[model samples]
Target: MVIKSSMRRSVRILLVGDRGVGKTSLILSLVSEEFPEDVPSKAEEITIPADVTPEQVPTHIVDYSAAEQSEESLCEEMQRAHVICVVYSVDDEDTLDRVTTRWLPLVRDCCSDCRVPVILVGNKVDLVDYSTIDAVYAIMEDFPEVESCIECSAKTLKNISEMFYYAQKAVLHPTLPLYVIDQQDLTEGCKKALKRIFKICDVDNDGILNDAELNAFQRLCFNAPLQPQVLEDVKAVVQRNCPDGIAADGITLTGFLFLHCLFIQRGRNETTWTVLRKFGYNDSLQMSRDYLHPSIRIPAGCTTELSHKGHQFVSSLFERYDKDKDGALSPKEIDNLFSSCPAPLWGPDFHRTVTTNAHGWITLNGFICQWVLVTLLDLSRALEYFAYLGYNTSEKDNQLSAIQVTREKRLDLAKKQSSRNVYQCHVIGPQNSGKSMFCRSFIGHTLEKTFAPELAGNPQCTVNVVQVYGQEKYLVLRDIDVRNVSDPLLPAEVQCDVACLVYDVSNPKSFEYSARIYLKYFVESKIPVLIVANKNDQEEVSQEYLLQPSDFCSRHKLPPPHPFSASNKIKRDVFVKLATMAAFPRFHAAWILFYKTRHMKQLGFLRGDSVVWWKAGLGLAAATAIGLFVVKVLKTDKS
Candidate 1:
């Protein structure tokens, strides 16, 4: 079990009952190993070291007597006590009668806000040959805080240590939180917590804990694997008791919860408590903050991303949930994937934000990309879901191992190449400039398929995998909404790995909006800029500005305006260009020259025995080679 730092360091047990119930003798007997003949009205506080206790927690024993301590003092000790021991003489009926009538009521009155567990200690049992266990059990049902009833004789040292052990156990692993005596079943809170654990252990989402998953869960909680025979024996026990508990030769959720309830019923509350604490649950059955959000520091200019281990784990999880053997996860499969979480982290808008298949199902690539997006944008939330999704292993103690902080962006720029696999591009344009369609097209959605009425009002962000120089990289396109020409872009909106300024070729005024946005945001920034003329299939009109799109891009030393038409087939090369620009921000001019030369060759402008075209292509290729050489020399000199 993992002990939280927030838990109490010591267990305080206060003995409160009628004065002649041998409470003082019980304390002295455990300390000196012998009952004192001349006992005082009250014994001084006794402390037990942690090493000597079964719970490995320091214990403080307090004795209460009406002759030595005032009522206020008794109430103060009662309030401070972690667990209260209600001592009663087995031979004396009046002492047992006052247990429910006086001492138990006083404990409730003093600590009304917080329920403290109580152990009913029947001291001086040697004085009577009869047993009062039945009478004590009746009173226990009335006061739910009472954990257990044990009879021991202080004079004979009978259960002298056992009584204190039970007292300590009551405070450390109390049964009140896990079980209810009246209903003979687990409490609602305990059931809910165990259900979550059951869901997490059911790795295949089949609603059953197979042999492999059960052993894995065993190793996780107990630090040791279970024997084959022992596993079968446990299943047998659950099957004999509850008929519906076993299913498909494995333990169902009903069986899982039944085992925990059985543990609490058989005075084995520590078993359930151990499982709960190992899974980051506290005494109240709520997930602790430290476990949900472990401490992770990201220095200035650095971003967070999933490590290789994180990617592997999430990939395996997706495969486990993809029951249909398809490449994507349906809505039901997605729901099962996040069933262990408190609520679904991704909402209806998630489909519109990430790359989806033709059926609008989230693909494996899209699933990983979404995690990457969350890790970069909101790390705390990612850590929270990491905990929720059971992202833990024996090799790693916390979620920190699943995440990695990238190097400073400035360092990547200084190196002229980024080692990062994900890049963000803000697609800034006017409302009618095909901004939304442009962003969606990056994820393989064409203009005809973009009119989804269900996803109309969703956030304008789409992520997809792109190949940049034979390396797979994720490119995130965020459509920046500009209400009017006078509306200025926020600093957050302006910041990105690359800026894509889109304009409608058919709209005369659309180019002016793109121009003004670029001049205002990208002119003085180090971020690479790409100008795109959307709606190229329509009739092109001259822009109502001082310069056309092509001339403006050239004047600003930006990439030439690339024509795009989502009305026809969507070209993926444009996205590749954007990702390449973002990957090597400092080598933009070289990349532009290199791509231009490659485009000329791909279009066969230098082929077909055309001397003029061949000469032009040769001149462009030589110039591109020289530009790349100069950029390389400058980079080497700087390094």
Candidate 2:
């Protein structure tokens, strides 16, 4: 889907068209491969997001049926609606005519508040000649209201995304990069990717993540996903360091911090460092630091021959008229200096149409484009240099092996931060120490649906962790009821990576029980555990049931218990960290189940729902031995 840059969330697009035109078949062919001939009229929610930055427009599409009026409900589905695409098969000229006359006015009236971005889609264009497609594009230009036009065949899946891209540009901001994902619709692959992304962002290791976690996760995947300044949470490093402003100077320490957050939010994942290495930072941190600072003063004397060379080779300035002028091309000439080797200057495949002739002398558009390329190269260079520093690079290109995992500690740290392991985490907190509350808090308020007044006040209504799309991360939650812990519907033999045993600080009894159940019954030797003391908001947490992190960790025989409040208005980042702290127990349990009952099931790595015995019998045996030893030691010598 085409979206304005820095859209944190995916867009949902609805495609409405006639049946034989292969509406369902088209969307499915590009996104989901299994397209049955007979598609029942239904509305499916699709999320397609590309380009991420605060204040950037994110395109959303919702595809539906035109024939089945009730089925076409994108108007009610996608909020703050942008574009509505009216799909028609080029093979059927009749449907095309109907779109301009009927569908156009219908959609316009339906979404009267904003001018809906309309894409007059000509589907099944693969069968038509190239000129025929061009005619369709031209015909669309006549529709003054029509933002853009494109011909795509859903059957052969030709340029399907380009159609959506044009539609998104009409209503949303135009400057954003058009994210042409193979398929932006909700599909098996998208779901899988969502799962992976969720796992990476849930840094605190909880089954879910909050807003801070979500933002951080995005930062980890792609740097500059959105404009950094708009992101309130990610403060500018320079802002912090240079509050007074460095209008005439290089970047300060504070600027780096903002950049740091940008990197985490939008940096290259496993290979971000690799991207930085390509841009001349080399292997020296000192040199990289210097470029960031720009130590050399601006030339006062451009007449010098050495200054002239610097301008040509480094700045790419004034080769045009500066025959005698060298590195010291006048600042005015520097503006158009990059025309010499526009394509090859960046090595290869620069794809930038902007050049010396770009955007008046400033060539703002071209400059921005070049900056993006240079940034990518810089990232490549920095990443490569960092990798080499971590691992020995013996090649001329000095390439570091792009191995996801490595034996070295630095690489391991990088992997942990960049690539997260997807695991089933269990929340094992006490009766009301806020286990359920923590889950809700972790998901956050943005995604929570408000209930009708009747249902809101009704008792016995609760949102269980069956499976939820987390606000910050996407995860499947399984809330093990108190009675169902030992025999969870999931599986009797399954063990989870963590069992986040929680206790309410206000209620001492519940806290005690939660701790015991987490250590003795729920966890085995193979499984690790984390204890959490939820309800920090309550006065009793500190005044009555006081416990330090170290004390709690020692008492539970687990990692220090994270104490926090899960009431409404939670700090998203802090909450996510607490959840991750609780993830240990769940991870341990998952592994135990996998080892103990290996043959129970093996769902595909990407999509798995079968029972896994993460809790191994061998683990239980080891725990039993330790228990027996303790009993023997406690026995009185009454014989």
Candidate 3:
């Protein structure tokens, strides 16, 4: 039994049994999850029990077993056992006979042949004959050491709770408080997430739930929801925060709550659960318990800090992996480094044409190697050679297959962080280069009409100013007002990462102006300005003005500038990628997943005309092969 309440006291429990008697199963069922050890492995939620009163302690049954124990050791096990469970099966006559012959001697060694409060568990009830249940109960009647042993089953749950009740009579108070906490202070997001947690466990969003949500969330997110006692401990606090007639229409949840509910509905990676299990931290429960106790005044603030740190760590890892100047690694390269699980050198899978058992199960060495691969990303650089296709294979074959199954989750998390974090970027070019037009595109308006039909020198000119933002509570694409200024504008006002100077590639004069501007802002002072030569469609802008990218970088004495087009075939998606990269430089790791998915999208476009071209090539090969086959047949016929 375990106890903790508004009263602030602690409860302790002890369980003891012979090893291999299904003790671990009972404890795992009670505390861990009912997750099956098969198929797309799950993370079942563990619910804390609702509170039991002071007089009635909350009964938490944990069945502990030691496989090898001496008589003295068995005696020591029962010292702290206020409630003992001498478990046996109704179907196993020999094991039942041993309850008197082999088992009670161990109990007697501990407590000198005295009767203890206990329940006789007839495990595997699903596999037993019901007729023997009475005979099993009769066996306990002769043993004074067995106080109230019922012939109950563990698997079919036959009288399981009743058995616990019998055991709890020696321990628990039946009328314990159901909830504890001041509900008024809960955040809407927390409340909403919690309500969904309740729905998952309770199976309906009826404002109260436990146990079942644990199972559902486990199936979906590969993570268990809150435990039952944990919910009970905070129930009052939830009610206070979600007061009646507050955001309810007659009764309705607020918009904020709706979004939070969406968060609950979100998917989770099945693979992550595998990794968590391997690490022995299968759920967030053990991790969050000591960190978020009621004694802490600002409980949520700590959680916020932790989340921020995790986001930063993820971003930092991304930055490290994006090796090429391009914002993202090609899918093949990423999968080589982070996508696949590595087999160990000790196994048959380690070398070419090796041994596996006739049964298809690997030897001990092979088994260990495969089992060690809990997650795909655990593969390091040394093992990358085996991941990609041979040189004969084309780039189209590349895939970050490790992430194919869970890319949605990884991308979702990255998006959340990018939206929340502030980063820097810039644009560059010269006069009449549509610099202002491009910048305005970020805010979704255009000065194209304002720049057209110039009357005088530098007519309708608006440049030399940077947009400074402290913090945007809204998205960047919102139509915000802009103010332009004269030359030598101080970027300190904007505090941006870089600046932009646009020049018309069609106009030689404009290109000259663009060059001079780059020298002033970036070349001399080295303040990082990106030069944009616009008007690629116009014949006036010659091909020479379109830098081979590398030469442009050389000429500018800076890294090559990523191309931007107000109009182009691939401009939209390319720009989105560039914009994401520029906005979040720390998003280095995500770039690989980004481009892999991008390239994967191309598979949908390989149809119609492309298919005809491939078919034509195939037809030629088939014709040649048929011609050779006819020649051989004619030769055979003549012979």
Name the best candidate (by lDDT): 1
Please name the candidate that would achieve the greatest TM-score relative to the true structure: 1
Give RMSD (Å) of candidate 3 vs. truth: 24.7
- Which stretches of candidate 1 lie above 4 Å from their native place? 1-6, 452-456, 595-639
Candidate 2 lDDT tens digits, 563-607: 667555665443333233222223333333432232533211212
Candidate 3 local lDDT, 254-281, one digit each (tens): 3224333333223112232232222222
Runs in model 2 lying further than 4 Å from the true structure: 1-8, 33-38, 48-61, 70-80, 130-139, 165-172, 175-639
Q: What is the TM-score of each candidate against the true structure?
A: 0.90, 0.26, 0.24
Which ranges in model 3 have alpha carbons more than 4 Å from their true place?
1-212, 215-424, 428-432, 435-500, 507-517, 524-529, 541-564, 571-639
| Candidate order by decreasing TM-score | 1, 2, 3
Every model: Cα RMSD to truth: 4.9, 27.1, 24.7
Q: In model 1, what lDDT does residue 489 have?
A: 83
Model 1 Cα lDDT, one tens digit per residue, 1-639: 212122679999999889788999999999999889999888999999999998899999999989878989888888888889999999889999899888899988988877788999998878989889998889889988889989999999999898899888887788877898989999998998888888888878899999999999999999888899999999999999987899998999999999999999889999998899888888777888988999878998787888877888789888988999899999999888887787777776676778787788989988998898888788999999888888864335798888888788899788776767789899988878887888877767788766656335657678888986666888889888887879988888999999999999999999999899888878998999999999988999999999988778778877678889886588888898889888878878655554344335432243355555466546645654554576568669977
Locate the minimum summed-lDDT window of 10 residues in model 3: 386-395
The Cα local distance difference test for each model comes to 0.84, 0.41, 0.37
